[model samples]
Target chain A: MQRIQWFKWLSLVLYGIPMLLVLVFPFIVMVSTSFKTLEEVSQIPPTFIPRNPTLENYREVWNIIPLADHFRNSFLLGVGETFLIMVLGVPAAYALARFRFAGRQPYLIFLLVTQMFPAIVVVLGVFRVVVALGLLNNLAVVATTAASFSLAFCIWLLVGYFSAIPPEIEEAAMMDGDSRLGAMIKMTLPLSWPGLVAVGVFAFMDGWNEFLFSLTFISNDEMMPLTVGLFRFISRFQIQWHHLMTGSLLATIVAVALFMTVQDKLTRGMLAISEK
Target chain B: MSVVVCKELVKRFGATVAVDHVNVEIQDGEFMVFVGPSGCGKTTTLRMIGGLETVTSGDIFIDGVRVNNLAPRHRDIAMVFQNYALYPHYKVFDNIAYPLRLRKRPKAEIEERVNTVARMLGVQHLLDRWPRQLSGGERQRVALGRAIVRNPKLYLMDEPLSNLDAKLRVQMRREIIHLQRNLGTTTIYVTHDQVEAMTMGDRIMVMRAGKVQQIGAPEVLYNHPANLFVAQFIGSPAMNAFKGRLETDDGKIVVATEFGRFPVGDPLVARLKPDRSPTLGAREVICGIRPEDITLDDAPVTPASPQAQVDLVEGLGADAYVSLTIGGTTLIARTPADCPPAENQLVTIHLNPNKLHLFDPITEETLLALP
Candidate 1:
């Protein structure tokens, strides 16, 4: 057993070293570049780490871009869109989950069909509609549009979650002095919380990093989310590599934080879905 | 306690009639069980009575009041599902208290009642534990506790013990019967297991093909089944049925089969239709004999006794089931397990004519009753 354990650990280190290097190498290079002066960055051979690291890149990025406002806009839009997706998607998913009315199968098919078409195909029409509605440069409009684009996926994910709960549990509740609606609220919803969290986190990440819809719908700098705002760091005349790298690192950190907050729930949701 | 009456209750799901027109009356505090094979509409009937399913046609009355339009909660009934249906997320205390909470009972009363029932069920120690943390038997008790805490007008149980292991099933069966008796609560239990029906129910309702075949006490149904379905359904190993003909032999009625002619007693003669065909209406009648009623002897005592060849013997400790072939007909005789005759041994088996059941070939109705 001891020999086998040592061999297994040896193989694990051999396999893990390259994977770790590949993932961390880029972030390390970016951080090192962000800390270097323009002269040092332009050197023939790149340095893995700067001789002297400074916080100047972060300060320059914040000063050059409306980083605080952009961060606020991204946070607001992502949270709002994800919340709207859950609010609208859960009920629609539940309706498809429990009831058997006419056109239910077609309705589900229609929702799935929405996911089939890439966003680029409908971007023009959606832009025209947003312009007509006079919501072209509004963050609320951007959030709503992002929600509409992602709601289909959220509903699809939630449908699997809702349907995974045994119908008998609801029936048991109904028999235990509850109406159908009451039974759903009291039994099914509580049991499916993990699935809800999983889908919620997925929608959050999707909206947080979304580039196309935010770009097409919002043109104003104040309403520009982090994805679009990050583009301002690059120009034809000169590219501020340090600020861009710092901003990219910041975005990665934010997304990772959001994911880590709900990581346990995500694992539970996957287990729940697979078990069912 | 309340009397539940279903008058011509019918349920149709799209094109299939899950429950056909069926009528039954369950008296106050009576433990009525609907027992049948799968897809026999027993669970559907129980659901209809509980108002879980909408009635296609017919009225359901509780305490002499029509309740077909009432919701499940308004019907003031509680049900225990086969899978226990204890809320996996809720602690045992909350699960038993859910019904009372829904009814908006006083908090003190809910707590008191929950604790009382928990103690009664011997689950007080498990009150803080979630349902998934409990064993199958403990979960079953919690389910029962949830149903009983409310003191509802009726208790509807749908095969609650069907999920347990064999030994636990038997143990829980006795507990359920004792609980029902002590509480004197009207209950309607549904199960496909006839043993549960025979042991637990005050009256067993045998159903088949979305209809009630027979409704009687266990012993009554066992001895005097209303039809061939009930006879075959109610007994373990089932009643042995063989095709035979009813004939008048010297002013006495006798069942004539391919094997031989056996005299039917005078009590059964009046029930036989004289105008029926040689098959007792069509071409053959069914004769049912319980395994216990047939006896195996080492030698034939009289000329009329039939000689049997023992095919197999199943030693069951207290008794042995001996399969025998008489002429071309095969039958099983429950005999003493000790000193059972060896396989292929020739023996004289006597069929107890008094305990025989005769059914019409065409209608499958009981043509004669045992004395």
Candidate 2:
């Protein structure tokens, strides 16, 4: 028993060391680079830690660009757009999962086909529409298109979660004097919160980090999200390395914090699906 | 007067008919059971009455009012699902009190009703726990409480005890029956188990292939099965059946079966009115009798008693199932436990009068219904 225990620890360490390095090493580099001076950042031999740690990059990135507006835009677009997708997606998924339609299987395949189009390619077509619709320089346009891009995958994940629940639960609710809609609200929706949260988190993250659409579609600086705002530190000649690194590091921390809050939900949702 | 009336109710899924024009009237406060094999549309019928499944082409009447277009909640019916269907998130109190809460009943009344039901089911202490925390039996009781709290006009149950172990199922069977008797609410229960059908239902409706084969009291079904389906489906261990020829010999009717040549009685002959079925006279007929109705005498006291070879004996507390072969056919006889014949032993068995049933092989219709 002692030998087995010892062997198990050996295996964990063997597997854990490289995985931790691959996962955590880049974040450490980003943080350390964000604090270093320009010369130190571009030094001949790269240092793992900043010898002369400073907060100048943080102060400059805030002042140089409309960084605060970009931050606000990212959140509004991320959370607001994600909320819209959920309101629309969960019901569509429920119908697809629970009810039968003439072209359901083919329609699902078609939704998946929509997911395969590259964001860059789709953004070009969307910009053409934006020009025709006179919606240029609109943050809403960026949020709407990004949400549309993420909608199909969101519905697909939710369909699995909804379909896993027995229809009997809803039927029971109805028999308990609830309307059909009420039954869904009271029974199916609550049971599927974890899956719904996972979808919300994904859409939010996609909206937050979205770059190509926000860069090309919204030419106005005030309307730019963080992903595009991060580019203001780069010019034709030289990149402001520390400001860019500091901006990215801040974004990463926010994403990490949000993910940490909902990682339990994500695990729970996946576990619910996998259970027989 | 009947409290529930389902008239020519039909449910068709695409080209397949799930319920083929069923008609049944349930008395006020009666416990009516629907019994059949799986996919025989018993659950579908109950679901239709509950308004979970839509009425494809028929009208349902509760208290003589047409409820075809009424929703489940509007119909004022409560249903206990086969899997309990208790909410995983809600505590037992909230789960049971949900119906009252939905109607916006006063706070104190909801609590009172929930408590009353909890105490009735002996789950008052567990009322604060979530459904997943309870055992299967506990979950089943909570499901019952949820249904009973509604005090609806009708109750529908879809094999609600099928999930429990055998011992618990028997115990719950009695609990439900007792509860239903006290409540005196009209109920329609669906089950595939003949024992539950016989024990719980005031009347049993035997169904096969989406059509109701028989609807009558349990004793009526056992004594006078409307058809072969009811004869075979209504009793435990099933009725012993054999292919045979019905012939008149020496002014007596006798069934010449591969199992044994047994004497058929006047009551069965009079019931068949055999002279009317000239085609049925020469054709093969099915002879059925309940297992308990067959008397075995290993040491024959009569010269005319038929002999059988016992192949197996399964002893229960009061009786043993003695599987025997007579001539070339096999049949199970319910024998006294103390006198179970040893395997492969020769024994003499006699059929009881007034209990013989005959069915036409081609049609499988009871001869009693022939004329």
Candidate 3:
């Protein structure tokens, strides 16, 4: 048994290190490049670690562009999309989870079918709608678009979470003198808190990292999120690889931190429907 | 207190009928139990009266008010589910006090009522604990406290004690009976255990295949079952049945079976339908008798006693069940544990002639109105 244990761990280290390095290599590159000077970043035989470590890239990256304004735009878009997805998704998911009606199976299939196609496939149609509404370059338009794209995913996840809870809890509440709506708010919502937080975190991350729709919809520099704002560093001339890496690293840390906090609940919520 | 009347209640799930036109009127403060095997519509009937399931076509009246259209909350009833359904997020105090809080009762009243119920159910010490922290029996007590706290018009319990261990089930059974007696509230209970139904109900309703087979006081059911199903279903060591034909042996009526012939007493013959008495000759019938009615004696109790070979003996402290067979026909006879016959020993089995239950071969209905 001891020999078998030693062999198993040896195999894990042999296989796991390369797989892990593949995942974390980009973050390491971003960190190392963000601490390098402009000349050091452009070196042909680039040093994996900085030869002369400095915070010059971080200081220059902020001064060169409206990085603070970009931060605010991304923050607003994430919070906006999360709020909209939860507000619309909670009730829709609850209805799908609890109510029995004709075409329910078909409707669930339709929700899945909505998620099968990529957003790029319908980007033209969405762009047409945005132009017709005369909301070009609007942050609200970008947030709304991102929210619509992820609504199906949010609803599907929340339906699983809500369905995981025993319906008898709500039925017991109803028997105890609460209306159907009242029972839902009191019994079902409290039990589904973990699921709600998981879905909200996912929606926030989706909006925070979103690029395609924001690029297509928003043109103004002040309204641009980090995804498009980071592009200003790249010109028809030389690209500022040091400043670009610094901004990308900053944006990634926010999303990673949020994900780490709710990692436990998120896995459970996702596993709920699959387990069923 | 309220009187609940279900008028021709029926529930259908698509092509299958779950409850087939059940009609029962529960008296005020009566304890009515619906007992049956799985898929027998007992739970469905209870759910319909609780307003959880919609009635396909029927009327449910509570205290003279037709509540078919009313919501469950409006109907003013409390139900204890099989799993107890306690709010895991709430503490024991809040779980019991939820109904009053929903009704917007004053803080002092809610606290007082919750405390009173907790004391009554012996859960006052666990008031601060969550449901997950409590044991199965404690959780069951909390569920009971929640049901009784509101003083609702009626209580509907769906196998509330089924999840507990056997010892806890019996203790809770007695406690529920005592609590119901003191409260004097009408309650409808559903369970598949015949022992629970027999012991707990003021009137037990036995159902099968979405239909009620019999409904009466427990004694009435045990003494005079409406049909073959109840006769066999009610007793623990189920009533033994033997296929036989009624015939005249030397000018005396007797049931002749493959094992042997036994004379049918005059009292039993008088209880049979008078109109069919003339045609009773050579009529095939099922002879049913409870285990307790069949006595195993060392010597023949009567001149015509049939001797049986004891196949197995199961002792239960006070009494023992002896499985006796004669000519391939097996019958269980109850005998004193101290003097049980040894295995494979020959014993004279004397079936109490007066206690015999006769059923028709085709319809399976009782041929004699047992006195």
Highest TM-score: give the candidate number. Answer: 2
Top candidate, metric DockQ: 2
TM-score of each: 0.92, 0.94, 0.93
lDDT assessment of candidate 1: 0.85
Ranking by TM-score: 2, 3, 1
**DockQ, structure candidate 2:** 0.59
Tens-digit per-residue lDDT, B1-371, candidate 1: 99999999999988898888888999999999999999999999998888878899998999999999888878889899998887776789999998888889999999999999999999999999878788999999999999999888999999999889999999999999999999999999999999999999999999898988989899999998888889988877778888987776766667777777777655555555456534343346799889998877887788776788999999989999988898788898888888799999989876677777888767898865434
- Give per-residue lDDT, candidate 1, residue B33: 95
Provide the overall lDDT of each model, using Cα atoms, as 2-decimal numbers. 0.85, 0.87, 0.89
lDDT of 3 by residue, B164-274 (tens): 999999999999999999999999999999999999999999999988898899998897887889899998899999898888888778888887787788898888877
**Among all candidates shown, the one with the greatest lDDT:** 3
Which residue pairs show backbone clashes in model 3? none
Lowest lDDT sum, 10 consecutive residues, model 2 chain B, at B273-282
Over A45-102, each residue of candidate 1 has an lDDT whose tens digit, in order, gives 8777787778888888888788888888888887988888978998899999888888
Model 2, A153-176: lDDT tens per residue?
999999999998889989998988
